[model samples]
Target: MNYFTRVLKYGIDYSYFGLLNILFNILYAIFSALAFVSFIPMLDVLFKQTEIVYTKPEYTGIGNIREYLESYFNYYLSNQLETDVSSTLIIVVGIVVFFFLMKNIFNYLALYNITFVKNGLLKNLRENLYSKVLNMPISYFLNKKKGDLMSRITADILEIQTSYLSILELMVREPLTILFTLIVMFTISPRLTLFVTLFIPISGFIISIIGKKLRKDSKEVQQQQSNFLSIIDETISGQKVIKSFLSESFFLDKFKSINSLLFKFSNKVINRKNLAGPFSEFMGILVIGVLLWFGGKMVLISETISGTTFIVFMGLAYNILTPAKNLSKSFYSIKKGNAAAERVFEIIEYNNDRVDQKRDVELIKFENKITFENIEFNYGDSKILDKISFTINKGESVALVGSSGSGKTTIANILNGFFNPKSGNLLIDNNNISQITKESLYKNISIVTQESILFNDSILNNIKIGNLDTKKEDVINAAKEANAHEFIEQQLDGYNTMIGDYGNKLSGGQKQRLTIARAMLKSPSILILDEATSSLDSKSEKKIQDAINKLMQGKTSLIIAHKFSTIKKCDKIILIDKGKIIAQGTHEELINSNSSYKNMNELQI
Candidate 1:
């Protein structure tokens, strides 16, 4: 109830719809009880020795029940026609019509209201989950599996909507049906009603014991499903790499191993769930058999309860067991759905970890200089950057170069405000960057990393992602400036050509050029280009360098270059080693005075 209540509170704002649904369900239960009670009158008509006579039932609210039904009974069979039109025939026809109408009407209302509830709940859940994802710190993603997160967003939420919430509806509706039918049974014979109440508790206790294993098995099955999805995602995203290495059999073996675990857990869940239905039904039938023998003896021996009343009570009592079966089944479904609900709530409840301080201020535009003062950063036990201090004046180009693990990319990440230093401070225009909004800082800084992130969209749309409002003419100009215009225009659709997934339709140099076009379109005040030309051929690098020179005309730039030729033109070069800045100077000064730089250059030459 607590989980459903919490989900409901966030699911819809108004409570009136839930109240309305309850009211209709009550109406449905009332009609359902009357449909069963009509069987008593039917038996009288069938077993009549003379014209069937009736008096109001001596029970609370029985007067009203009689008034609503007696007139229809009289008109249906006139006194003269008692030989042909017995009360049994009339009652049977009346019960069929009443239940048919109630069934159709209730089914419609139930479906209509649940549609609203399902879609509304899904909408709110998705909105909240996506918002939480956006607000979470970048570090949170590093620890999570991408496929698992994706599965939570897609499959887990859908499971809650379909399995859990749907079972909750049965939790209410079916119990009411069973309760109303039991009340009618009590009215006909208190002894038989007591007989029914006896077996329900025993059967429920047994069913609950069997249901205990459901949650554990369901959780294991869900985990196995997520593992299968992760392997599929990896295989699809890395298809080219797998093909190059010819590892299809390798991936298939891994998938099969996970699939086998899923199959084992699924069997456990199904067995536990399937046991509830048949075991409850068998127990109910056994109790019904005992009631028939005991009650038939009391009636035959001229007990207070008549034969007709006892038989009608038996029919109503049998009706109660149907809903009891439904209730047991719903309980099993709840246990299974709870596993998915736990996974969904786990994601929604995750801590964002990074919190904005009260003293934080919004940044506008950088004016003076960007400074990193004695900054230290570590990822777990390994220091990525240590005691790093540097200053970049307005409109200056700085290059950082070293071997693979030399803290070069870490510096770019820090400056772009992706990661805050573990100790020390980063100041932009003399104001501490930590005190400003990350989004605001990003507005002034543009980055072109080694991985070219292009969506499956038109070339025009991909470039327009830089500045959503940029004009088409401006995109063409930016593309030309990035030296991508010639290849772009040669396409069948020119700027409208579909790039495909990750720009798969294009070559590496073409993708890089498009990425550069995007950065140029952004035209930010500060730019960071990490290995912008390293992956390209010498001819492409020379052409892209011409584009880079034009882009850096009046903007401050941080260049992370592997090639000596690209590094030679920087206003200054900072040599980083083992997270520390061990050398800093122009290329010429470093080549002359620094042994490390001369040796690195000699190796490159």
Candidate 2:
């Protein structure tokens, strides 16, 4: 469906609250019009033009209710005046005050009910947006900017709340207020009401022109804001590299350019939105000016309407201006909100081709072996893995050794079910891995990557994330096994020591050990180490390598190693070159038989 239709559908989902709002708003509008209409009799009293009446007014049909109301007021005023003229004036003033008070009370209730629907829709929209982002495939985010996604969730949703959700108030309350006011105006004088209606279309046509331009500019403003946010995110993430290269000016210039565009587009949208209020007011005054001339002539020359009724009609006409201005502004806001809704829905409705299909089988347990049968994988059009086949039997530690781009890491990714191969089957225990639910598949496996991914939390908390139910003793034991217990104990708070973002507070070796400690806590049946110790110094490497050995004991392991020293003692080594396996053997066997393996081993040495 179109974006506007989608926005209305979101409102329809919460129609219960909207309907309540409508009921209150209708009451508010009727009271509001009656409050202004109450002034008609007060005007008659002030002018000493109260009509003389001896008997109660007779009942009349709806068409003559205005005449009936006027006659009844005259009948009461005549009685009150005979006793005390001051008391008659007091009663008229009291009636006017009561109508005004009731009008405001109903107005407040309309706003109260509208607030619930507004906030409820916003809460649902944000939750759904975040859930969709979490469940989307990893590949879907390969090209997406973190800031763009963040903008969609945060700023874009806020825009929809202000522009779209607030439309409900304008749609129900404002239009009904105008309608009620016009009914009173028509009752007072239909000729004057007819004259006012003729000029409304003209004002609407002008407002529509401004709104058309506002929508186009509003979409650009939102897009530019997303771009600006992306730049800020990239700058913050790569601050180290930017500072090291002394390229701060370059990024500053880029930010300034995006910010400048945002400023210009925003100015256009605001200018257009602001114009609606003043322009509608001006058009309203023009109509009122014409009415004053024509209606005043009718009162004085033709004597078709009274002075007090004409004054009340004028009050109602001016009252219509406020809702008219609001209606015009609401139109502009809906246009802007429609743009934001499109961006939000784009992510919420994203088709993640990589999401696992429904699997009714019980949770998978890794038993025999993981086999890659003729695996062929491509990224875009570039072949990353081609017709490759291998197997790692249960409790065996096999290292995948290859050049930088020879598909070693791709094997780890596919095996971990992060991506599916273009043409292949990764079988776990003779059962297709694709048939296993991702949660079930991942429960039996753990991965430690080259970079340590840690949150800004305590050391104990980070480790506990692997298994929330793990005991303190078990966590300490896991840390001891990973060789991290020593350094952790040295910290002021020991296990409770706060690790900063990405574990930046710790040394590379300390961070790697903690990650190993985390994985050790998981104690999975299978483990994948993707150059887990590649960035560590020799001393740290030896410590982490010892931990790796301890963690790999009696577990099925896949090691993608760049350093020959790291995987030299594996049960077997599969040497890959340019997406295809060229050889598989022990280190000595490969050194004796394969030139490529010998050359890589020599280069590392």
Candidate 3:
């Protein structure tokens, strides 16, 4: 379906609230017209045009209800004029004030009800976007910018709220107000009303032509904004690298370039949007001028309409312009809103190729082994892993040794179900890994990466993230096992110490130890260490290595290490070169047999 249809579908899902707004708006429109129409009688009283009646007027059937009400009102006013002309004018003024008050009251109620639906839709849209982002596979984010996704969720959604969602008011109140005003105008003078109708289509056609470029311009503005936001995110995230390289001016130039494009697109969009209001207003006044010339001739020459009635018709005609202008603006806003909704729905409706299938069997524990049978994976068109086959038996620690681009980390990613091979069957205990749910598979495995990923939270909460229900004693014990307890205890608040963003307040060693502590708390059946200690100093490496040894005991482990010394004691080592496994043996066996393995080991030593 089209974007507009999709947006309307979302609004219709909350039709209960929308219906309430519509009902109140209908009342508001009716009362608003009556409030202006009440001016007709007051004008008569002021101009001394009251028709005096000697007796009460007879009630007529509903078919002639309009005439009957007019007669009844005249009879009451005539009697009041005879008694006290000043008092009769006072009563007419009171009735006019009452109608206006009721009109405003209904208008307020309409807006109040619409607010609930508008805000509620925005809340649901954001929530759904977040949930989809969380569930998307890792590969989905590989090509996406953090800032672009962030813009979709924040600024783009807000644009939809203000531009599109606010159109809810125009949809109900403005159209109904114009519709009711037309009915009153037609009753006063059909000839002038028909003349007004002819110009409406012409004005609408002109306004639509002006707005033809709005959606395209709005899309450009939103895209430029996303680009600007992406640059900001990249700049902040890589501030350290930029500062270390003394490339501040380089990034500043990049930001200014994108910002300039954003400013240009914004100007174009606003120029088009602002044009709608004035153009519609001018067209409306032109219509009014024509109506005055024609309707005045009918009143003064043809004598078809009275002076007071013609004045009321003019008021109704002017009132129609307000809603008409609002309707035109709403159309422009819908175009912008449609553009934003397209961006939002792109993320929400993205097809996740790596979605897990429903699994009836739960992988509660790893018993036998994890095997990769003839695995072949590709990154775009280039092969990353080719016919790679290996197995790590239960409680065995196997290290994958390879060059930087030799797909060692890809194996770890596949093992954790973050990705699936293009052609392979990964099995645990002879059961296909794809048949196992990711949640249950991840529950039995834990990973520690080269970079420590920590939040800006208390150390206690950070450690507890591995297992929320973990006890305080268990957290301390895990920290102790990772050789982190001593440093943690030295802090002012110990476990309760608030770690600044990404644990920036802590040293590299301390941060790595905290991550190890988190993994240790999970205590999974299988563990994958992807150069977890590669970034630490020798002293910190030794401490973390000791923790790794403690955590790896009696657990099936896969190690991807840059330093051969870290994995020298593994049960076996698989040496890969350019997406193919060249050899597999213990370190001593590889050193004696394989030249590639011997050379790598020599360089590290």
RMSD of each: 3.2, 2.3, 1.9
- Ranking under lDDT, best-scoring first? 3, 2, 1
Full-model lDDT, candidate 3: 0.89
For candidate 1, the lDDT comes to 0.80
User: What does candidate 3's lDDT look like per residue over 166-209, in tens digits?
Assistant: 78788789989988999988888888999778877998888777
List, residue by residue over 491-524, the lDDT tens digit for candidate 2: 9999999989888899999999988999999989
lDDT of 1 by residue, 1-605 (tens): 34555666665643455666677777677677777666655565566622243433333476577554564464444443445554547546677687758866985686566556656776887888888887777767877888788777777777677666776567767777778888877777777788889988998888777767887788887888788889989998999999999999999999999999989999999888888778878878987898889898888875867676777677777777778887888778777877877887787888754446532666677677888899999988999998999988888899998889988988898898777789999888878877777778877998887787899999999999889999999999999999999999999999999989999999888988898899899999999999988888888778888888888879999999888888787888999888899899999999999999899999889
Which is superior by lDDT, 2 or 3? 3
- Stronger candidate by TM-score (2 vs 3): 3
The CA lDDT at 492 in model 2 is 93
Best by TM-score: 3
Best candidate according to lDDT: 3
Quantify all predictions' global Cα lDDT against the true fold: 0.80, 0.88, 0.89
Clashes of 2: 0
Error of 1 at 454 (Å): 1.3
Q: Which stretch of 10 consecutive residues in model 2 shows the poorest summed lDDT? A: 353-362
